[model samples]
Every structure is written in structure tokens, then in C-alpha cells.
Target: MISINNLTFNIGARALYDEANWHIKPGEKIGLIGANGTGKTTLLRLIVGDYTPSSGSISKAKDLKIGYLNQDLLSYQSDKSIVRVAMEAFARQNQLHTEIEEILEKLETEYSDELITRLTDRQQEFEQLDGYNIEYRAHEILAGLGFSEEDQKRQLNTFSGGWRMRVMLAKILLQQPDILLLDEPTNHLDLPSIKWLETYLGNFEGAVVIVSHDRWFLDRVIKKTVESRKGKLTPYAGNYTFYLEEKGIRETIQRGEFKNQQAKIKQEERLIERFRAKASKAKMAQSRIKMLEKMDRVDDVDDDNPEVNFSFRFTKQSGRHVVNIEHLNKSYPGVPILHQADGIIEKGDKIALIGANGRGKSTLLKIIAGTETFDGKVEAGHNVTMTFFSQHQLEALTLENTILEELQSFAPTYSETNLRSLLGSFLFTGDDVFKKIKVLSGGEKSRVALAKALTADANFLILDEPTNHLDIQSVNILIQALQQYEGTFIIVSHDRYFLDNIANRIWFIEEQKIKDYPGTYQEYEVWNSKRVIPKPAPIPVKQEEKAKKEEPRPVMQNAAQQLKKLNDELSRTEREVETLEKQVKEIETELADEQVYSEPARLTAANKRYQEAKAALDLAQQRWEELAAGIMEIEEK
Candidate 1:
């Protein structure tokens, strides 16, 4: 329950918002999306009262509690344990608890009736607020966000910046505010933690407003989409998928209307020019001129943002087996991350290596990339040139070198124009190429690293969380570029949507073993969901028959029980198949629409969805068939 009426905010000469009216209702989940520097975060700050609007007002219920998680971690007590820091979320409850304890100590020393009454009142208030469970709740949130029990007792300063951000997130979640405002909450989280957050938010009773670049997370968590663009807020009534569909329709219609107006204006101007001097048509020509002057020109839709367009160029082709690992084992000190891991990477395989944090997904990638040593046989095939990109690779850049010089060092044969053009593709244009690496932000350094990797004529690319610092548009660009490349690559990423688009195979690492699934991430998920948990060893046939005879079959389904269970499963599988088929049809219809074909991103996304849905539908049908056969077998029995 927050409302903004005619909200206007400005930063220097730019109007971030002008007369913007938006209402966030109770229990609503909204996603804020836009290009980089489009004031998404600024709007969040304004709503949270950190920044005053230039004009208009933001209103909220007087009792509404807002928890805002900013991109930057807040200053915290370095010496305090993470659990203690998180417990501070319920400061009032903790204070009451402390006061109640003090009152009890006073009662032991012949306290007055007033002290007893105060203690009783404080205890009632604490119970009313569920304050007694505050410590348990804090630990639960910390564990869900990936802090081990030992980590909870560790000082906050011992954690890295990313983990510190996670601690802040845990604190916010523990507060359980009426409205949660998160900006890039998933930026620092691994896949497992992100999924945990998704489940937590799915069950949260309060309203949520998040700004994120993780499309899959947004699609799963948010019910509404709000775009901040050109000093206005546009709302979509559905999730990110529906938002994309509706946005495509609106842009297509807008472009058509603008084109029609331009055509009519051109025709009117031509007629006026031809009839200007005619005695009989002078009045008509003058009237047309006045009409032209009064007509508001239709501005062209602004959709032509510069897109990144470079592809990986290979100097030579690699053998069929690009990388082969056997009995790989790696450990650090007392921790063993991977053991007896074996896998093969073909020359043209695009593999997505995924797992929970500290489970050795990145370690496996490093081992395969030959950047790390291990106790296993890790071999590369003939002519397999590798280029690796990691956060550490960004740190390895020479801080004294300019962006242009960095690329030049990587490829000394490239001309200045070639270097500048390549840098421009990654959003470093003109004088930006001359900026020293020392002054670059993390995102800038990431882009430079990506650009360098792309320019290298490597046949096999090993990238770890390549899209961590990229915006949605840049990520799409990279996806498109990678889709067209003929090189083999192993990518470690938590972005499910990105993996869906690029990964042809899934290497899921669990319990120190690599399980290879020959499908996309979505397919892998469906398969994983359908995996049969090992059942306890069956009792002897005589015992089972004796128990069955002794147990009365009270008026129940009886003989049809097994059949009924199979029928229910069959029905569910059939329904899933139907839903996926429907999605495929809808995406196909959109792809067929002439308007959507004009936007490459929309077309690409639609096509990708169509393929994925078709694949899922096929899997569902197979599952349905299996269930039907099982039911028939049970009926015969």
C-alpha cells in the first residue's frame, strides 16, 4: 500500500520522472525494469524517502514498514557476528527483551509492584510480536541465504563483499516489512541461494518491488512489470513473459501509427506545394498549410539502442574432443570440493556447468580451462586454444593500460581503427577507450575482459558468470553473438534464462560428482523433477501378502488404488503437455505476427520459447504414455 500521485523528480538537467502516477497495492509483486541509468534505483530511493521528489508526492500508510535493500552494502559493525547483526532487525523486540530481563533482576532484589507490572506488560508485548522466536528466525534467514551455522558466528568483516550483501539481504528478510524494495538482490547470489530466495518470496505475504536483470527470476517471482523510460512509468498487468508480449504489440502498433501519420503529412505537403499559386485553389492550399502547422508531429519510436555485435573468431578448429577429464580431484586445506569427477567436452559443445556455491562448479571449469592444477588427468585435444574469463581475470588486467592499450596488448597485429571499433561494440566509445583501467568500475572492467576474450582467436572459451555485471540488453547481445559462434565453450552461470538460450548440454555437479544431462536447463529441470527417489528395500513377498491379508480393505478404492494413483499422475502429465503445447502455439502465433518480426529481440525470444515449449511438450507426452502403460499393467494385476 503505497501511492505516488503526479510524481516528478529531476537530476540536474534530466527529468527522471514527470507527473508520474503509480499505485502499488497490498500484496503486489512488481518488477522495475529499464535500460542502464534509467532511474530505476532512483525511483526506489524516492519511494523510500531517501531522496525528495522535485515535485508531487509519494504517500504510504502511516503504519507501513518498508525494508529497502540497496545495491551497496550498508556500513555495519565489523566485529559483530552476522547473527547479531541480523538480530538487530528486531531492535525494538530485543530492547523489550532486555528490559524484561532487567525487571526480573530487580524483582529478585525486592522490586516494587510497578516494576512487576512493567515486566508483565513487556512480556505480553514481546509475545504478541512473536519476539521470542526472533533468534530462530534470524538463523533461518541466514542459513537460507547461504551462511553456514559456523559462518553465522563469524564476524561480519571476515566475509567478502558479495557475502556481506547477502548478510544485508538476510537482515531485510528477517525484518518482514510490509513492503520490500530490493535493487538487484540476486546479483550476489548463487543459483541455489537464488532459488531459495525465489521460494521465500513466493510465500511472502507482504508486497515486493524488485529491480533486477535476471529475467528468469523476475518471470518466476514478479506478478507485474513496470518500466521506467523517458520520464514516465509504464505498467504491465502480468509477469515478465506477458510484459514482453504486450510491449511488442504496443511498439508495433506505435510504429505503424507513426508511419501512417508521416505518409499522410507527406501527401498533404505535396498537394499544398502543387496548388499554392492556383487562383481557384489558393484558399484550399492556405487551409492545408494552416492544418499542417497545427498538426502535432508523430515522433519515431525510440528502440534503436546500440547493440553489441561481435562474435568469437577462431584461428583454427579443435579436435572432436576439446577437453577430457578423468578422475579429477581438487581440495583446499581441509575442504574437499570435488572428487573423482569425469566429463568430456566436444569441440562444438556448449555446456552449462551449474551447482550450489562451494560445490566446485567453477573449480571444474578452472580445471578444464587449465588455469588450475589438480590431481586428475585433464587433457586438451589438438589445436584447442582456450580463453578464460573470470572475475579474477578482470583483476588481472594491467591497471596502467588504457582500454585500447589492453586490447592492443592482447592482439598486437590489430590496427587502431579495429581496436576502437571492437571496444565500441562493448559500449566503450570514442574517448572512453583511452580511459585507464585503474579508474574503471567493476562493470566496465568486466566488459573490457569480455571484449578481450572475444577478440582472442581461441577455439574453446571458458567463461564463469559472464553476465554478472551486464544489463539485460548487453546480455541479450552476448547471447546473440554466442549463438552464432562456431566455437566450443563451457560457461558457469546462474542465469537460467541465459542458459536456456545458449546451453545445449547441462553438467550438474552434486556431491563431488558431475552428472551430464543432454539437454537445456529447462529440460534438465523437468528431468530432475521427475527423478525417482530410491525406495526402501521391499519386504519379502510372504510378509507383504500376510500384511495385505491381515489389513482390512475398508471401503476404499481397493483393487483400483494403484490404478487411481497412476490415473492421477497421467492426468497431471497430460495437463502439463497441454499447457506446454498451448504456450508453443501462442509463441508461434506471435512469431507469425508481422509486427513482432521487426524486433530482433522479440523474435529471438519468441523462437526460443517455441523451441523450449516444444521440447517440454514432447517430454510430457512421453511421461504421460509411461503413466498410461503403468496404469494398464496395474489394472491387469
Candidate 2:
């Protein structure tokens, strides 16, 4: 447990935190949320002793261990394999293992009673520490974080920054520290890896404080919410959703109180104005003025959520078919991205392109934007104008130009006044538009690039991870902008909440083909959770003949009879699969419940039932597939 008492931190003259207090209790899951530049990460660092507060103190329980994960870990590089790197978390176990090995080698040559005793002691400690299973635990965590077995064996330096960040996260999870301070932990994680981490943290015994822009993740994992704003920390008793509702209620009450106080002050002033000139009433008026001055004024609520007033304009409306792809084939070296993948983006189609990392989501986006080389045709529809937005575009911004200048150059048709107004909506108000691009942070630069991308006279938008560095408010503004736009767009983002609000269709790549789900991301998730695995490919002629020799085929009176029998069996199997699937879902829901997960016996029972139901579902699906395949064969004949 950690207690931050009257913590005041300042960066030069600006107080990032002024008497901000938060008590992180054991086993509590807290989400630290605020808009950009509100010092969420700085608070985490303050708690971890990386930065000392200007005043007050951050006191921690004696011998408490803390693990901090931040974006800086993305630069970590090592020649060692990822598994070896992750195993470094178990320092004591590794040391004991080394010592025990040395003792065994010594006994091979110079055996003695003292050496044997020492070996026994070390072996006992090693067994107690579970040293033998450390490597296996490390591998399990790495796999959960999205590393393949082969990837685990590869050197860490071979991976990109995002992948390297995942390695650092794996190492931290392996450590299992008493307190986890994660700053945007989901920034580099894919949907599957994020889900895995959510499950892992849900069952984590220690306390956790997370700073993230991901609302869906926070809603799923965090039990408490804390907002950092206006040099103060405000606590909410529940998750983000609860915080929003509670904050709204508080704001309404505050507004009422503010109105009542203002009315009282006005009435007092009117009385004073009417009677102050009379010598007899001067003292009473002066007394009332003093009381008014001493009254604590309730501050009005801050407008963190800004409305999007700017609308996208295009030179010409795009044709009904915005983009058409035909047999799209793209690959790199040994990695095949899309093979004969085909998809169409019609007018007003807001597609959320998503999948696990290394699934070529970005590659597909670039291909559609006409920026990447591919083997097949990716043709733009008639009268279509396009604009592409990616993180790489942030680097394309001219450092010497001011934010306003950058936008002006990008959209010459728009006047300076309109550009400034547009910039204001992106959180650059007053003199902020005059700041040089070089002085901006990564998030600021991303906003500038996004502003340019959105302001373009293009009907088709290709946005790849636009919500990467945006805060929740900024993402909401984007959602608003996209909602108002009639143009078609395909966006690649891991932010589920953002996607669910903006996308009307979900697009993902599976088996190297573009797959489209005609619904929102939330609906796609439900469908995907129950999607059945496809049957295996047909055997070759030689293998089929060998199988025929090894096994006897069932004889039927006629093809019609065989078809009817297979159809009937398939129908029965389908019903069984559905029942088994429902049973599995029920068990999974129970396992997800806090009461069941927190109780060992209940958890064990639920897990057992889940496994049994899953096995039955798999068997039923296999039979269904076989029956359907048999029906297909007979019908073909």
C-alpha cells in the first residue's frame, strides 16, 4: 500500500500537481484518467520514486515492491532471447539454480559432506521457489502477450518498438510486483493481447493503478476511477462509467449551489446599494461585504468535452463504390499478408479494420490508400478523392511551421480564421496555434496531422491508428466528426470503444482473406466469440486411397438414402452443438464472475465444467462437419 499525502509537484513554474492526494490500497484496481497534459504519467512516476514531489511526501509500506511500465521501455534492447529476458524477473530462483548447478559440478570432482549439505539446502530453497517451472511460467506469459514460441527464442533486438514494449510488459507481469503502475499499457497491445492482460490483471492479487485512454479496457478491469484535473485528484467510487454518471450528478448539484450563492450575493449587493448611502446603514452594508468576500465560491465545471463543429468538405462527391479491391495479394519475404483478398467500401461505409498484430491491418490500409505496392488491383472508385492518416504522417509535419501555418499550407482553400477554429476544436486554442510544430509533443503532433487529414477535401479516408495518442475526449470528438461525415472511411484501431461508436461495419483479415461483418465492433465480438472453426482441407488422392485401405466406408442402399441420412445426422449435430455452446457460455460467464473467480473451489468447479463443455462442443462440431462433408460428397456424386 502507498499513501500520497498533500503531494505537490512542479515542473519549473507550472504545478502539475498541487496538493494531490491518493491512497493506493492493496488489491484495489484503480484507473487514473484525465485529458492530455494533466500529469497522469507524472503521478505514476512520483509514486515509484522516479521523481520527487516539490512538497509533501509519498510514503510506501516497508518492503513493498512496485513495477512500473511506461512508453520509455519501448527503447529497451537486448541480444538475449525474449524468454531469457522475461525469466530475469525471477532473480532469486535463477541465482539459486546457478548455485545448485555449480555445487553439482563440484561434487562430481571433489565430493565432501559439507558440499553435500550445502547442495541439499540450496536444492530445498530452489524447490520452494519453484525454480524448475520459472522458464515455463515465463513462456506462458510471453505467449499471452502475443509472442510465438519461435518469437520467444529470437533476440529482443530483432523486434520493433511496439514488440519490444510487449517484451518489457511480459517481464513486468512475470515479476508480479505488489503494485503495478501501468501508463497506457494497451498502447502497443492488440485486441487479443489486451484481453489476455485484462484477464491476467483481473486475477492479479496485488494492487494496480492504470493510466490509459482506453475506456473499454478501464471499464472491464478497473474497479475504481480517479481523475487528475486542475491541480487536484478526485476519486470516484466506481469504474469509468460510474465516474461519468457520478460526475454528472455532482456537476448538476454544483450548478444549483452556484446559482443559489450567486443569487444570494446579488440580493445582498442590492440591499447594500439601496442602504449604503444612509449613515445608519453603512456599518451593516460593510459587514455584509466582508461576509460575501469570505464566502468560498463554487467553481463551475470545466468543459473537457468539446463539440465538433467543423464538417468535412470534398470537391466532389465520391461514387457509390468508394473503393473496390479485386484479388488483392500482398506479402513480404516469408510473410503472406493478403491472398486473393477482396472487399468493397461503398459510399458512407465506416469500416473498422481490426485484428491481432502481424495480421496486416496497416498493410491493407496502405494498399487501399494507394501508398503500398501489391500484386492485385486496388482501384479507387469514380470521382473519389482520398486522404490517408497514419502515425508516420506526424514526421512529415514541418517543424519550422506553426500549427496554424501547417494547416493553412495543407488546406489553402480554407482561410486562416477557419483553420484556427478547426485547430481550437482539436484542443489548440488561443495562442497554441502559434506554437512551432517542433515544440509540440507526440500527442500534439498527432492532433495536427489528424486535423490536416480531416480537413482535406476528400470523400474517402484511410486512418490507421488515429486514436493511438488521443485522450478520451479527443477520441469522442473524432467520433462526433466521423458521425457527421457522409464520406466513406476504413480505420484501423485497437480502441474498441472508439470503433464501436464510429464503425457501422467490422472488417478483419482471417486465413489471408478480407472478411467483413455487417455490424458494429460490439456485435462482431459476440459473433466472433461463437464462430466455429472451419473444417480441415481435403486429403490428396494418394492419402484418400490410403485412408480407404485403412478404414471401411459405410454402405448405403442408394445415393439418395446416404444423402438423407447424412442430412439428418447433420441436423441433429447442429442442435447438439448449439446446446453445448450455450452450456459452455454459461460456464464461462460464471467463471468470469468475481465471486466465482475469487473463490478457489467455485473457480475450480467452473473451470472444470467449462473445459468439459468446450470439449463436448468441439466433438459436436467435428461430427457436424463430418456429416455435412458426407452430404456434400454424396450430393456431388
Candidate 3:
């Protein structure tokens, strides 16, 4: 589709791409990843002709269609509805349809071979443009991005900037260009929206180039990767996970080459020194000097190590249960974010908390970590040391302290030089160590916050969406390092791929509640899939003597059939009750339990027996419902 031959671009003295030769097939889904300021964005801009390269050329086929969504993508006015803005992408296709209709109308009155052929050609074009499904597709994209039917009719100007970005993404997805380019597309998306995008891009017919900080998103949507580093764009086969292992292999080869070249340089240096003192080899020295001067120097090959991978070796171990929360209730001004949320994290547990945005995911983390106040109970394990990383953690950094000094304070046992070396693992090296905390960018500040929290001697790590703003490389580094970590972790993240690789259990937060799932992330997904219709096949009850004698397995079959029938009814009743509850909440005022006008003893007794006799699967599903409720209450609070 698009190709770059000998591409080179520079910012001041730093070269982003130096004579880099790279090409992407027409339908390839490629991820552009690298360290900060490595020119990933610049390379993307060059592809879209937004910026000119310093040298070399970028070639593209004529008549090629491209849809690029940059960080500064245009947004609709707040006053405009979401549907109106998203419909703009289909304008060209709509016009083509109109023209085809006009041609057909003309053909009804007058007929000619030439005119007939032209009409047929226009119809084909309209079909190819998906003119028939344009409106449907537009609505589908908007709805998947979290815009409700009511929201679609609301004025766009009334929405926040984050929501406006969703409108921009919906427009891009609707266009269906030959090549789709997205930068940080998942930043504003909720779980459902992210999943929708993954399924959409995974099957996209056109070429795709996405720049995202979401590790899980890249692993699912991208098929290939083009990474810019050390002044070159290196190509890798497969997705981000594939690039991870492949990049390790490539680094090994480069390291071997670097070593061999260094050995040769050292041998020549020794020879030149020895020859300088000998008159007999003066003629040979001239030849060696010419060889050394003409030799093309090889670039330094850095070590093949993950970034921001600081070790957290605590002096003491935590007790059996690392952290616990009971009946947690929290609320902020204007809305209730959480109501009666509960959770528990034992030693050696790696838990992931996931929900939609503004659903108290971070709030749950803060409450558990004791960084924020709550109404419910929170208990730490015996001798359990805790560390936390919040979105606002950068505010904790001291302006007067250097990077080295900050590390020395918590990990003070290590020498100042050693502390600086640890900071280098997080990309703070040499003069960067001396720079004040206030001088760093948002991403850099986040890295520093993560480094400090993870490096401390703590038995438990409470990380709230730690992967936000981190590139694929940095995210993988943290993923691998965390997998090797010995402490318990309660992580809240939208990156499903990361959770799949590391988390042993799930702490789902939603509504005004928290629920726990005892299994891997994959198992949780399987359980969640079952919850939609609840196909939990109950165990067959024992057969009676008469039934066993008459028809053998009839009793078991009858019980199984009965269970299925009950389950069908249960699902229907549950949906009806849920619908009624929503309607009731909307219409009736929230009254206290005392205002129910019922005897407390009878109500409590009836609910207990009904709940106990329920299926085990439904009982296990309580956590999800509670979490969902917590999410709702948290937002309301």
C-alpha cells in the first residue's frame, strides 16, 4: 500500500529514522512502537504528508485513500449531537448514491447504450462504497463507542473533551478508508468499546497503523510492528507479543556483533601502541593507520533488557492475607462512586480490577491502599508493607530532590551511585537524574512515579491502571517484571492482555460493590460469558429405585430437563426484575429501609431462603453484580 525507501528524519542532533527502508502491505495491521521521543509520531506524520522528511522519500500509490486520526484530531462542537458529527464520514458515499439515483431516474425516460453503461458503472461504485449500509454502520460504530440512543441526539458541544475524542474515532471508523491510522485510540474507550474496536480492527480489510499505549489492544488488533529506535525503523513480524520475543533475539545478534567488533578494535589498539616503540615495524604502522581511519564504526549495541524494571526486594514478608476490605462505601461530591464495596487480597495473589471509565476502579485501589478515606473497613496483613501508585502520584514528588536523592530516601541502604543506576533502568540517566520533578513530561513523570512505588521495599503493590501513557515496549517490560515479582499485587487496568499473562484472580469493581473471582483472567471471561444467559449445567440428581428399575436414566434426565427449564425461567425473571428496578429507580424516590412498611423479620427471612436455594453459579455471580453496583454508585456519588 505504502512504502518508504531510505527514509531519514532528524530533530536537532537526534536522528529518528536514518536511511530506514520499510514497507507495509496493503492490508497489514502494523503497530509503531519505541521509547519516548523516538519519532514514532514523526514517522506517522510523514506517511500522511503532514511533515516533510529531512532526506529520502516516501512513496504511495496514486488514488489511494487514507484516513488519519492524530492526537490533535478535530472535534465536533458541543451543541451538535453525536449522530450528526459521526454521519459526516458518509457524506461522500451518500453523494455517490444520490448521483446514481439521478442517473437511474434519467434512464427511466431516455435510453442509450452509452448512458446505460454509465449508470451501471455508478451503481457498482455505490455498492463498493457500502452506500446501502452507511447509516447502519455509522450508528453501529457510535453505539459501540458508548454513545447511547439518547446521547446520539444530544448536542456534541455539551460533551467533555474525552468524549469528543470518541466522536472523532467513530468518524474515522465509519469512513472505512484504504488505510486507517489511529493514535492512542483506546485512551478514552471503556472495556466494551475497546473490545468492539479490537474485533473491528482485527477483521478490517484495509491496512491499519495504530499508535496505542494499550498493550492488550495492540496484541489483539495489530499483525505486524515497525519500531523506531537508535535512528532506524526496525520491522518485526507478528503482533506486539511476537515483536517482544523477536526483538530479544535481534538484540542478542547485535550484541554478539558489537562484542566481536570491540575485540578487533582492542587488538588494533594494542598493535598500534607496540608498533609505535619499534623502528623495525614503522613501515607496518603506516599501513595499520590507513586501515583504522577507513574502518566504518559500528553503532553501540545496548543491552537487551526490559525498561523501568526496578527490583522490589523487601526485608520482611507479608502474612497470609496481604490486604482486606469489608463493606467499603465511598462517595465524592455530586455522585456516589462506591457503596458497600468489599475485597480481600492475600499473600502471593495477583489480582486485576477492571470496569468502565469513572467506575471507581482507581477509587477502589486508593481505598485498599489506605491513601484515601472510606467508610468501610480496611485491614492490612500482619507485617505487611504496602506501596501505591495513583494517577495523581506525581504530586508526591519533591521539587528540591534529585532523582538519585528520591531513590536514596526509600531505598536508602543502597549507595547514591547505585540509586542513580536504578533510576537509569527507568530512563533517567546522567543529566536526567539532576532534572527537577517539575521539568518532566506527563509520561516521564508517570514513569518516575511507577519506579518509586515499585522499587520500594513493600510486600504489596497497589497499582491503579499503571499501564496508562506507557508505550508497548515499556508496558511489556513492566508486564514481564511484574510476572517475576514476589509480592502481592492488586492492579486495576484495562489492558486485558497484560492481565491474562499476570493476574491469578479478578477483583471486578462495578455498581457500588466489589466481587472476587477465584481463577485466571481467562476463566473469569468464561464465567462472564456464561452469565449472559447462565448456561450453568447443574449436576444430575440421584435416581430413585422405581425410576432406576423402570427406565434407568429417566430420573437423571428428568432432573436435568427440569434444571434447564428452571434456568430459562430464572433468566427471564431476572431480566424482568432488572428492567423493573431500573424503571422504579427512575420514577420513585429512594426511601430508607424503614419506609418499606414491612416487617424486617419477614423480609429478611424470605430473602435468605430464596437466595440459599439458588444455583451455585448464581451464588458465585454475586461478586460481578456487586461490582457492577459499586460502579454505578461510585459514579452517582
Candidate 4:
């Protein structure tokens, strides 16, 4: 649907892409990935015509529609409600519907055949456009993106910047254009919303190209991977995992070839130098020099991956119970976030708090950290020193302070060498440490905050979305550091892969309660799948007695027939529940595989099927329980 030939783009004097060629076909989902500042977002802008390439050409079908979601939110009507802005995506459909309405009104006055034909044609067009379901689909998309019904009714300006970005995303998805260009779509979404978006994009019937730093999300939504680096574009036919493997192999081969060519060149040079001084071998030396001059030199392979090394050190140990919460309740005016919640955090326990947006995940973290006030009791165990990191931590830094100064402020006694060494481990080296905090990007600021947190000699940590602005590599480094720390921590993050690797327990906040599941993220998912079946309500006493009385009557024959019918239904429901449970387990197992997670289509299909089966199993189990109760009542009589 879109084609690029010999595309060249430059930022100032540096060329980001040179003679790059790529083609995106219909229904293809492609991931645009690379390290930060590699022009991934710039390339998307060039494709969407927001920026022109320095040279070469890009083309697309003349009539094809393109939906582009930029990393930065566009200026929209702030006074409009969220739903109103989203529904604007269907402006053409809305226009057509209005025309149809006008035609129907005109038909009441003029009964001419021409008028009737025009009305009929317009009505057909409206129906063909699916105008009737536009509002319903808009609502579905908005809700799936984490907008509450009340939130949708509020003015757009009332929302935070992150939520406003989500509104923009909703508008783009609602448009359903022939091609989708998304840059960091999941940056503002929670885990549940990210899962919903994965499902939506999986079922999308158009071409998609997305630039994101979210490794797990990219693994679950994209079919192909395109990497941008060092003025070149490299296409990998498979997903991110395949791309990684193929890239490794390519780099290895290139290194080998480069080494071989260098060795050959060195040998030839030595031979030429040694023989050039002798009159008898001068001709041979000249020939060797010429050959060396004409030889095609192999450029040394550049290492694109850089490592960040750091670890946390604790000065003291906490008690067995790091934190204890009893009868925790938090509320604001008309909203109740948490109610009568209790939880215990033991030493060395790494807990992940997860839920949809505005579900009290952050609030609970604050309450536990004693940063926010609540009407409950929260106690920290003996010798429990704590460090808290939040998005606001980046903003809390003195903007005028250099990176070195920022770290020194936290630990004033640390020498210059110590501070620089710690900063270097977080990817800020030499002159980078001298840059003012105000000049740093979001990712850089996040690194500074993380470095400070790591240097703190606290044994308890509370981190809220610590990976928000960090790239994939930095997140891995943080995970490794956290893995080695002998501290108790509670983290709230949307990065599933990070949580899966770092968290040993799951603390899920839902419906005003905190439920603790004792296992890793993958295990929690498997257990939660089976626990979705709610307990059946108790049978009414009068209904049970009625069944008992009818069992011994002349209606005994009817009772027997009813019993047989209930038995059959119970058997069918039980079979369906068992089958769905098995399917869910199988999919969960597949999802646990790193390779399977990289295949977007397979992952999406498995997730969708698991959800469907879970719903079916829940209902079936409920019905089966009801039927079994009925049979027992009949037998008792």
C-alpha cells in the first residue's frame, strides 16, 4: 500500500537514512525499532508527509487513507467531550446520515419518482457506510482505551497530558484508515489497555507501522521488524525475536569477513614493503601494491548494542515483614479507591501491583510509602529505610543542576570519581554528566532518577512505573540490578516483560480490594484464568422445598423426566468448562515461550481464544452448579 525507493533523510548535517528502500503491503504489521535518536519517529513523519525527505521518493496509492498518531498530541478542541472528539473520526459517515435524514424529510412533501429514487440511493449509501454503528464502535474503542463513561463526558482539557494522548489514539483507531502509523502508542496505556490494543491491532485489516520502545508490546503486535541505524534501514522478515537472532548471525559473519580481509591486506602490505627495496623483486612488489590498491576493503562491523551496568547496595537489613497494612481505605469526595484492604510484605518479596488506569495502583503505592495520607494503618518494619521513585521524581530534580550535582545532592559525601562512575553505569559518560538536568530528555531524566535511587542505602523500595521513559536496554539493566538486590520492593509498571522477570508475587487491585497471588506473573495468569469462575449463589429454600414436594407426587414421572434433562445439561456444561479450561492452560503455556510471544498473530489469537474460553467456562460452571443443586434437591425428596 506504501512504497519508498532510495529514501534519503537528514537531520542537520547528519544523515539518518541514505538510499533506503522499503515496501509495506496491505494488512502488514511492521515494527520500527532501534536505539533512541535513530530517526524512527522521523521516518514515520516522512511517510505521513509531515516532513519531506532530503532526497529520493516515497509514494502511496492516490486514494488510500492514512491515520498517523504522533508521539506528541496534536492540538484539538479542548472544550469538546472525549466522545465528541472521537466521533469526529466519522465525519463523512455523519454527513451521509444527515443527508439521508434530509432526503426522508423531503419525501414527505414531494412524492415524485425522482425524489423517491434519490432517497433510496442515499439510504443505501448510509447503510453501506455503517453509519448506524459508528457511535457504538466509538464508545467501544474509547472504553477499551481506559476511558470511563464519566471521563468520556468531561471536556478534553480536564484530562492529563497522558490521557489526552490516549484520546488522540482513540480518534486514530476509530478512523480505521487503510494504513496506520503509530509512534509509541503504548506509552500512556496500562497493562489491560495495552492487551486490548494488542487484540485490536491484531484484528485490524489495514497496513500498520509502529515505532515503540516497548519490547513486549512490539513482540505481541508486530509481524515484521525494521531497524533504523547509522544511515541505513535493515528489514527482518520475521518478528523481533527472529530479527535479534538474524542480526546476531549477520554481525558475526561480518566480523569474520572483516577480520579475514584485514589479515589478507596486512600480509600483502608486508610482502610489498619487504620486496620493494630489492631490485630483482621490484616488479613483483609493484604488482602486489597495485593489487592491494584495487582490493575491496571490508569496513569493520560497528557494535550497535551498548550495556548499562549498575547494582543496588543495601546498608542494613529490615525485619522479616517489610510492611504491614491493615484496614486500608482511601477515598476522595465521591470516589472510593480502596476499601478495607490488608496486605503483608515480607523481606525479599518483590511484588508487582497491576490494574487498569485510575484503579488505585499508584494510590496504594503512595499510601504504603507514607507519601500520601489515608484513613488506614500502614506500618513499616524495624530498620526499614525506603526509597521512592515516581514519574514526578524526574520533575522534582533541580533543573539547573548538572547530572553530577544531582547525584551528589543525594549522597553529598560521594567523591567526584564515585559519582561519575555511577553516572557512567547509567549511560551518562564524561561530558554527559555535566549537562544540566533541564537540557535532558525524558529518558535521560529517568536515568538520573534511577541512578539516585540505586545509590540510596535503603532496604525497601517503592517504584511507580519506573520504566516509563527508559529504553528496552535500560529496563533490562534495571531488572538485573533489582534481581540482585536483597530488598523488599513494590513496583507498579505496565511493562509485562519487566514485571514477569523481576516480580515474584502479584498484588492485583480490582473492585476496591487488593488480592495477593503468590507466584510469578505467568503463574498468576494461569491461576487467575481458572479463578474467574464465581461461586454460584445459594439455592432458595422455597424453591428446594417445592422440588422436594413434587418429587413424590403423581408428578413423579414428570420429576424423573426433569431430572434427566438437568443431568444432560449438567454433563454438557461440565464438558464445555473442562474443554475451555484446558485450552486456556495450553495458550498460557504457549505465551510463556519467548519465541511464541514474538509472533503477533499467534499471540493475539491465543489471547483472544483464552478470553473467550474463560468467559464461556465461567458461565458454564455457574449453570452446571445450579443444575447439580437441582438434581440433589430432587434426590433428597
lDDT of 3: 0.71
Ranking by TM-score: 2, 1, 4, 3
Which pairs of residues clash in candidate 4, taking residues 3 or more apart in a chain or in different chains?
A: none
Taking all chains together, the TM-score of candidate 3 against the true structure is 0.70
lDDT of 4 by residue, 1-637 (tens): 7889999998888889999988999999999988766788888989889899999999999899999998667455479888888888998887876775575555455545676566558656766887656766776788778775556777777666667788899988998899999988888887768998999999999989988767788888899999888777889988778888999999899899999999999998999999999999999999998898898887788755544344566779999989988999986544566789888999999999986666678879888878888987899999999999987788788899999998898887667787787776577876999999999987789889988887888999999988876666667777877888888999998888899999999998655678999999889877875532222111111111221111111222355776787798888888888887898788779867866544444544554565456556665676688789988876675
What are the per-residue Cα lDDT tens digits for candidate 2 across 1-637? 8999999999999999999898889999999999888999999988888898999999999999899999998878799998999998999988987887686666556756687577669867976876656777787788778776567877887777788888899899889899999999999888888999999999999999999999999999999999999889999999999999999999999988988988998999999998899999999999998998999998776677878877778889988998889999987654566899899999999999988887778889988888888998888989999999998899899999999999998899988887887887777989999999999998899999999999899999999999888889888889999999988999999999999999999998877789999999999999987534232111111111222211213346566776787788888898999999899888878966877644545654565576467656765776687688877765665
TM per candidate: 0.80, 0.83, 0.70, 0.79
Q: How many backbone clashes does candidate 4 have?
A: 0
Q: Where is the poorest 10-residue window by lDDT in model 1?
A: 535-544
Model 1 global lDDT (CA atoms, 0 to 1): 0.81
Candidate 1, which segments miss by more than 4 Å at Cα? Answer: 74-77, 279-283, 304-308, 400-405, 412-425, 429-434, 532-637
Query: For residues 1-637, could you state the per-residue lDDT of candidate 3 as single tens digits?
Result: 7889998888888777899988878999999877767887788899999889999999998888888887676444646677778878888776776776575555555655676567558656866876655655666677777765555776676565666788888888787789988888887676767998899888889999988877778888998988877778888988988998997887778778878888998898789888977999977877887898898876666653555435558889999988778888886553466787777788999998876655567767877777778797899989998889976888888767777667677677766665665566566778998887777777678888887887788888988778877766566777877988898998887777778888998976544578778888878988875442211111111111111111112232343454454455556656655654554443333222433213333333332333233322243344345445534443443
TM-score of 4: 0.79
RMSD of 1: 18.3
Cα lDDT, model 2, residue 192: 84
Q: Of the candidates shown, which would achieve the greatest lDDT relative to the real structure?
A: 2
